[model samples]
Every structure is written in structure tokens, then in C-alpha cells.
Target: MNKLSIIIIFIVCLILFIVLSLSYTKLGTFDTVISSYIQHFRTRPGIYFFQCMTYVGSIRMYVPVICILSIYCAVRKKLLNICFLVFNLWGSRYLNQVLKLWYQRPRPDIHTLTTATGYSFPSGHAMNAAAFLGFIAYLIITEHQLRLWQKTILLVFTTLMILSISISRVYLGVHYPTDIIAGSAAGIAWLLLCILFHQRFIQ
Candidate 1:
């Protein structure tokens, strides 16, 4: 996408975040309904599945992947790519923390399938999944010269990864549905801004 298009999307996502934040009380009903519905279908296999997906979204997975990618960039002498990658991931993580502290929203009172401790307005896992994986998808699309079939496969896989990670938080009962939505909006906004800056300036 062009810079202007990215900027517009960034703004739209920002507005979406703001709207969700302001309407959180009303959203709470929807959140509860969805959470309950998801929990209603919860199975032992589903729990195990989401547990793995949640771990994939965690820093445990992100840090190593980022380190490896950074090293790859270094070996290839792609300083700009290295900088953009680190800045995008680290910056998004830091922003997620700041937003969590700022919102200070409580985690769901439902029976949590996994242990989690934090203010949970915007799910950290959701933010990380959307920002990091979403950026990886963007990088693959923009950087690689893949065939149409390959690109389609990559896009589908990347999207599933992002959505699975985000939904896992809700499934685990540690985050509300609105939290996932808000985190996704914020993450996408930040990702777009990073891409726009990297493309327009350093790149």
C-alpha cells in the first residue's frame, strides 16, 4: 500500500481504538456473551490447542524469532531491515505495556484456563500477535518475490496465526473479547505507522 493509504488506515484504527475504549461499558455485555459462547464449546483438546497458540504469541516465541531475524539481517548487511524489525517489535511491545498501565482495566473474572497477571484492557498477546506477526506478513509480501499461490498460502497462514493467538487469550478467559478487538486496532495502527515511516524515510 502507498504511504497515504497506510496513514489513513492508521488513523482509522486509532479511531476504532478510541471508540472501543470509550464504549467499553456497553461493549462489556457483548464481551461477556462472546466469552461465554467461546467457553461453552471449550474442550480439553481446544484448551491444549489454545495453550500452544498462546505460547506462540508470547515473548518466549517472539524474542528468539526476532533475535534470529536480526542476525539474518546483520549477516545480509541489511541495516535498515534490522532497525525496522527491532523498532517495530520493541516499539509495539513498549506501547502495549504503556497502554495496559494507562487503562488499568481488570482481567475477566471468569474461570481462567491459564495463569495471567496484568491489567487487561488491550490483551498483550493480541497486540504482539497483530504487531509482530502482522508485520512479518507485510515484510513477506513486500520483500519476497513469491508466486501468486505462495503469496496466498503465506497470507492465509499468517492470518490464521494472528487470529488464533488473539482468540486464545479470550478462550483462556484472561481477556475479554473487547480487549482483543482494542488490542488489534492499536497494534494495526502502530504497525502501519512503522511501515509508513520505514518506507518513506529510512527505506
Candidate 2:
């Protein structure tokens, strides 16, 4: 891993550790308020909107798009860039699942707005959204020589996409605010780890 990426990963991990510790100790009120706010956003219209956005954010269905991008990079002989993209995408998903099992927190059962099954502490939707869009943003900034304005636009759009997907999980009554927060942290950490791996071994 590059020194910068390693530093970023370390910082993210430290923050996550602190956040998780605080959540179970002194942040009870904070967690409750955030969870309530997320639950309040689970109105019918908002739920529908977020659910639709979640479908749009589905990485499984989007793999073809990633494949297309990867192929374009390969044709241009940017093999290392392709590897980074593919590895981040797959590795992030794997890490998300692993953390979900590790956390093993149950989903909210209060409102009965939507039926969801599985552990919910770390929202998979949020993690996947962050990983997918965050990697796209990284690729745009690193691999593609886009103009500054183009990079800004891409970053804004990807950020919105990730936020929308995260909101959807809460609106669907499947994940708590803390779940999404942890998922986002985990996603970022996974991306950083992938970058580190590439810098250390692949580069």
C-alpha cells in the first residue's frame, strides 16, 4: 500500500473503533435520536423513492457496466487500473458480508413498513453503495484524466448516489443509522485496504 493510503486506512479504522465503542457506552442518546430520525424518514413516499434508488444502486446488476469499463481500460492497456477497480468492487462486498455476520445486530422491528431479513447493524446497502460509488469516484480522479470540473461533478454525483442508497435502507426499515454509519466506515476502509494492497503488491 502507498503510505498515504495506509495512513488513511489506519485513521478510518481508529475512528471506527472509537465510534463503535462510544455507541455502546456514552452515545445512547445520539444513537436513539439518529435512529428515530431515520425511522421518521421511512414514510411511504420516501420509502418508495429510496427503494427505487436502491435498485438502481445494485452492484450485482451493475457488474456489466464495471466489466465494460474494465474492458475499456484493458484495451488501453491500463491493466493495473482494471485490477484495482475489480478488486475494490469484489473485496468491498466480501468485507461487508463478513462484518454483517460479525456485528450480528438485528434489524428494526418497530414500524413494519417493509419486510427485511438478515443482520442489520451494518447496512449492506450503504456499504455497497459507498464501495461502488466511492471506487468509481477514485477511478475518475486517479485513472481518468478528467478536467477538474468533470471530477467535481463526478464526485458530487457519486456522493449523492451513495447517500440516496443509504437513506433507502433506513426508509425501508431495514437498517439503523448506526448501521449505515458503520457500513460507510467499513466501505471506506475496504477501499483504502484495496488501494494499499495494490500499491504494496501490484504496483
Candidate 3:
């Protein structure tokens, strides 16, 4: 990794550490308010859209779909992006599960709108969305042959997908706002780590 990228990664890791520490200490008043607002949105029709989209974003089940597409792209274009796709798909899934287990925070049962199992300190949907979409964004942006407009469109769509998936978890009442925040932070950290590794060892 370049000096600048290393610095960025350090900063991200520092911020993530601080955030996770504070989140575990106690829920601040603002945190409570934001969580309430997120739960309020859960009742709206928009949530259904986000929920379905988030479900689709789940990498555990979606990777096979992506693998199929990746195979098609590889065969048609003679591209060798399959290794990168597989690495990202597997790496993100393992990291998400590890973080979830490490946190071990219980899901919100106060208003229990959905029947989700497992801990909830970090929203799995948010993490999966960010990692999956962020990796795609990185690939599109880094592929020198791709047109600028195409890269820009891919970046925007990927960002929207990440945001929508995050909102879905909060709206579904399965995760707190802080959970999504942590998940997004962790996901970005994972993405940066992957990029750094690739640049240093693979690129």
C-alpha cells in the first residue's frame, strides 16, 4: 500500500476503535433519539422496499448469484476478475461473522418488529451491503479500461445500495442506528484492508 493509503487505513481503524468503545460503554441520549427515529421509519412503506433490497444484498446467499454473473463476464470478456470476486465474497462473509460473534450484543427486543436471530451490535445487512457494493465500486473505479461515466454510475449505484441496506436493518427494528453505524464503519475498514492487501501483494 502507498503511504497515503496506509495513513487512511490507520485513521479508519482508530475511528472504528473509538466508536466501538463508546457504543459499548453506554447509549447516549442522542443515540437513543436516533434509534427511535430509525424505528419510526420501520413502520413506513419505504421500509418494505429497503428490507427486500437488503435481503437481496445478503452476501451469504447472493454470492452464488454473483459467481454466476462473474463466470459469464469472465467467459464473454476473457477477463480474470473471478479471483477478486471470490476473494471479496468469501473474505467479507467471514469478517462479518467474526465481528458479529465478537461483539455478542443482543438484538433489540423492546419493540421486536421482526424475528431475527443472533447478536445485533453490528447490522449484518449493513456490513454485507457496504463490503459487497464497496468492493464492486472499487473494482469499477480501478479498472483502467472502464469509461469514467460508467465508473461514476457504478459508484453511485453501489453507494445507494449500501445506504438502502443499512436503512433496512434499522427500519426492520432488528438493529439500532448505532448498529448500522458500526457495521458501516467495519465494512469500510474491511474494504480498505482488502484494497491495501491487493495493492501490496497481488497488484
Query: Which candidate tops TM-score?
Result: 1
Clashing pairs in 2: 1-196, 1-200
How far out, in Å, is residue 104 in model 1?
Answer: 0.7
lDDT of each: 0.87, 0.74, 0.72
Model 1 lDDT per residue over 1-203, tens place: 78778888988999999998888878767998899998887999999999999999998999899899888878878778878888888898899999999889999876798999879988888887888888888877776688899988988998899899999998989999999999999989888887887777754
Off by over 4 Å in 2: 21-29, 41-45, 200-203
Q: Which whole-number lDDT from 0 to 100 does residue 154 have in model 2?
A: 90
| Tens digits of per-residue lDDT for model 3, 1-203 | 37597668757865984577466648756556877876766545776686687677776567686777587758767255666666776777787778779878888777655578888867777776776678767765665578878877887888888898787776766787778888777777777766776566544
Per-residue error at 90 for model 2, in Å?
1.9
Reference-based lDDT, residue 193, model 1: 81
In order of appearance, the predictions have TM-scores of 0.96, 0.83, 0.83
For candidate 2, the TM-score is 0.83
TM-score computed on alpha carbons, candidate 3: 0.83
